[model samples]
Target: MKKLSVIIVNYNVCHFLEQALTSLAKAAKHVDVEVFVVDNNSVDGSVEMVNEKFPWVKLIANKHNQGFSKANNQAIRESNAEYILLLNPDTVVEEDTLSKCCQFMDEHPDAGGLGVKMLDGKGKFLPESKRGLPSPWVAFYKIFGFAKLFPKSRKFGRYHLGFLSPDEINPIDVLSGAYMMLRSSVLDKIGLLDEDYFMYGEDIDLSYRILKSGHKNYYYPETRIIHYKGESTKRTSINYVFIFYKAMIIFAQKHFSTKNAGIFAVLINTAIYLRAGMALMTGFVQQTWLFFTDAFVMYAGMYVLVNFWERHIKSDSDFYPPEYLHYIVPVYVLVWGLTVFMYGGYKPLAKFYHILAGIVIGTFVIAAFSNFFDAYRFSKGIIVFGGMLSILALLLVRAVVQFIQHGNVKIGDGRKKRVAIIGSYEESKRIDELLKDTHYKLNVLGYITSNKNDVTQKGYLGYLEELEKLVQLYRLDEIIFCSKDVPAHRIIEWMTRVDNRAVDFKIVPDESNFIIGSNSSNKRGDFYSLNIELNILS
Candidate 1:
C-alpha cells in the first residue's frame, strides 16, 4: 500500500487540471503516492489527457457526472493507501504540500482528517482553510453578515472561525472537501463521505462524523495550495443558493438532536426561502431601478415646470391644459422612458450619455408630433422646458440614490474608481482607450507589467511583484487585467492577494466589442462586469 492516495474529481477544466496534475507531480517526488483521476464524464478530452500525460494515475471515467462525494468514494473504495486525500482539480499544490501533510499525519496519530491553509489564486489565504463547525448559531452569523462585520470576534465569526489566524494550527469542526486529508483508519471507522450529499455538504457531514467518532480534525497551516474555487458552480447562481443552503439543512437534520431538529429545520427552510425571495426581488429591482428613476424624475419635473408655466407664463390661453396632462404627459413619459430603456437605462450602472440621448430623441419625437397636431402645437415650449428640466431631475435623483446607497455620489457623477491596468503595453493601452471610449467612471493610474520593452514599460508603476505597494501609493480602487496577457490562474492569484484590500478586480478577456444601442449594458467599465455580493442579512 502506498503512503498516500490522492483522489481528484475532474470535470471539463482541462487547463486547470493539467496545472494541478503538474503540481501534484512535483509534490509526489518525496512521497510514495498513488494518484487517482476520476473524470466525471468530461468531454474535453480530460480522460485522454490523463492517459497520455499522467499514465501512472488510476483513471475512473464515469459514464455520467456522479458528483463530488460519490465520485471521490469510488476512488477511495479502490485505493489501499494508509492516507487518502480528496483534492479538487482546480487547485495547484506546492511541492511540499503532500510531503508536509504526510509528515503531520504521521506524527499526529489521533488526527482523523486534516486540512492545510488554502490560498486563493492570487495568494490570499482562504478562510475555509480552517473553519468552525457550521452549527445553527454559526450559520446564523454567516447568513446575517455578522461574521463579516465582526470577523475577529469568536461570538459572531464562528462560521469560518475568523477569530483564528490562517497560519495557526487548530482543531476544527469541519474541513473543506476541496482538500481533505483523511486517515484510512478513520475512514474504516466512519465509512466514506455520505453520498446523500450530492456535492456541497458531504465535507461537513464527514468532518462531523469524524468528531462524533472521537477523532480530532486538525487544521495544519504549514503547507499551502492555490484553489481556484467555483469552477463547478458559481456562488451567485440560484442553483448555488439552493444547493448550498440545502446542504446545510441536510446536515442539520442528519446531526441535530431530535428536540432541536424541528426548530433547526424551520430556521433553515425560512432562511433558504427568504433568501430566494430576496434574490428574486433584488434582480427585479436592478432591472427596473433605472426605468423608475427616469420616469419618476421626468414626470415630476415636467409636472412642476408645466404647472409653473400654466400659472404664470400662459395664464390666459390654457396652453398646458389639464386634459392634455392625461394624454400628453403619460405619452411623453412613456416615449422618453422607452427610449431610455432602449439605450441601456435598465443597466445597473448606466451611462449618462445614454440617458441624455434617450431624452433628446424622445423630445424630438414629441416636438415632431406637436408640429403635426394642432392640439399639441400649443404645448411645444412646455415640452421642451420639461425635457430640459428632466435631465437635471434625473441627475439629481441618481445622485441622491447614490448618496443614500453608497454614502457618496461620486460614483453616480462618474468621478469615482481609481484603476490600474495589468498587461503588456499594447494590451493595457487598448484597454485604457476602451475605458476612455466608453466614458467609464474610472481614473486609470498607470500600468503594472514585467515586460522589459521600453514601449510597454514607459508608464509602468512597478512589476507585478510590487502590486501591494503600487495599490497603496496610487490608492487604486480596481485592477483591470488584460486577459490576452494574464492567464486566468494569474488573475485569480492577483484577486486572492488583494482580496481584503478594499479593491475590485476585473478582467477584459480577449478582444473588445461595443454595442451602443443595446437594451442594457452588461459591463461596468472596460473590463468584465461588476459582481454584487448580496448581503443576506439586510
Candidate 2:
C-alpha cells in the first residue's frame, strides 16, 4: 500500500491545480504516495489538464459540481494508503512537507490528524492554521466584532485561537481543510467527513469527531505550504458569505445542544446579513473610489475654467445665472464621470488617453443635451473649455498618482512584464516555448541555470544560488521555476527567503504547458497555458 494518498478537490481553477500537482509531485518523491484529483465538473478544462499534464493522478471527473466534502469523500473511499491528505487545489507544498508530516504522525501515535503552518501567496501567516471551536459564546464574540478588535485576546478571539503562538506546535480545536492530513485507520474508525456540512464546516466537524474519539489534532509547523486563497470561490462575494455562514449554521445544529445550536444559528444568520452588507458596500466603494476622485478633479477644474470664462470671455460678471455654475456644471461633471466608467477608466492605473477620450465624449453628449432646456443652457465656450480643462486635470491626476504608486505613468500598454526563468538549459527552452503559446508579451531576461557548461547554457544569466542578486540586478517582475530541474523545496525556499513581494513566482510542472503563481495573497493564482485559454487571461 502507498504510504500517503493526496486527494485534491478542484473546481474551475485549472492553473492552480496544475501548480498544486507540480508541488505534490516533488513532495511525494521521498514517500510512497498515490494522488487523486476530484474535478467537480469544471468547465475550465480542469479534467483535460489532469489527463494531459498529470496522468498519474487518479481523476474522478464528476458530471456535476459536487460539494467539497462529497468530492473528498469519494477520493478517500478509493485511496489505498495508510495516510490520506485532503489538500486544496490552490496550494504549493515543499518537497519535504509530506515526509515531515508523515513522520510527525508516526511518532505521535495518539495523533489522528495533522495540519502544518500555512502562508498565503504573499507569505503572510494564515490564522486558519490553528482554530478553536465556535461554541455559542465564541460565535457571539466573533459575530459582535470582538474577535477582530481583540484578535489575540483569549477571552474573545477563540475562533482562530489567536492567543496561541502561530510558530508553536499547539493542540488546536480545528484543522483547516486546505491541508488536513489524517490516518486512514482513524478515518475509518471515526467515519468520513460529514456530508451534512457542505464545504466550510467539514474540517471542523471531522476535527471534533477525531478529538471525541480520544485522538489528538495537532498544529505542526515544521514545514509550510502556500495556499493561494479563494482560487475556486471569491471570499469577498455575497455567495461566499452565504455559503460559508450557512455551513457554520449546519455545524452548530449538528454538534451543539438544541438551545446552544439555536443561539449559534441566530448569530451565524446575523453574521451572514452583516457580512453580506459589508461585502456589497466594500465592493461598491472599491469600484467607485476612482470615479469619485476623477469626478472631484473634473468639478474642481470646471470651477476654475468657468470663473476664467465668466471674467474674460463673457465680459459680464452676472452674464451666466448662478444655477448654471452651481447645478449645471455639476451635472456635466457627473455625465463625464459616468462616461469615463463606461470607457473602462476605472481599471487599475488607467491610461491618460482613456481619461481624455471619455471627457471628450462626455462633453459632446452634455452640450447636445443642454439645448433641450433653457435653464441648463450655458455658454458653448464654457462647456468646451471646461471639457478641455477636465481632460487635463484627470490626465494629470492619473499620471502623477500612477507614477507615485507604480513608478510608471502607465500612459500606454507598451510596457510588458519583465520575467526571468530558473531551470536547466533544456527546461528553460521549454518554458520559452510555452510562453510563446500565450498572447501576453513578456520582456524575458533569460534563464538562471545550474549548468555552467558553454554547450547547454544557451540563455544563461547566472547560477540558481544567485537568484536574489539576479532579481535585483534585472528588476524582474516574475520568476518561473521549472520542476524538471529545480526541486519544490528549493523553489519554495527562494520564494520565501528572498522577501521580494514585488516579484511573482511561478512553477512550470515537468512536461506541462502552464506556469502558475500569485504575487499577492489577495489575488488569485493565474497562469498562461498552451492547450487552453482562461477568461482571466483574456
**Highest lDDT model number:** 2
Model 1, 443-482: lDDT tens digits are 8888988565533447777788778888888888777776
Q: Candidate 2's residue-wise lDDT over 294-331, tens digit each?
A: 78888888877777777898887777778876888789
Candidate 2, 448: how far from true, in Å?
Answer: 2.5
Q: Would you list the clashing residue pairs of candidate 2? A: none
Question: What global local distance difference test value does model 2 have?
Answer: 0.84
Per-model TM-score versus the true fold: 0.71, 0.90
The residue ranges of model 1 lying beyond 4 angstroms of the native Cα positions read 12-15, 42-58, 121-124, 140-156, 311-313, 316-331, 343-467, 472-538
Q: Candidate 1, clashing residue pairs?
A: 121-493, 122-492, 122-493, 122-494
Residue 17, candidate 1: alpha-carbon lDDT: 71
Which RMSD does model 2 reach against the true structure?
A: 2.9
Which runs in model 2 stand beyond 4 Å of their true positions?
Answer: 140-152, 343-353, 433-437, 450-459, 530-538
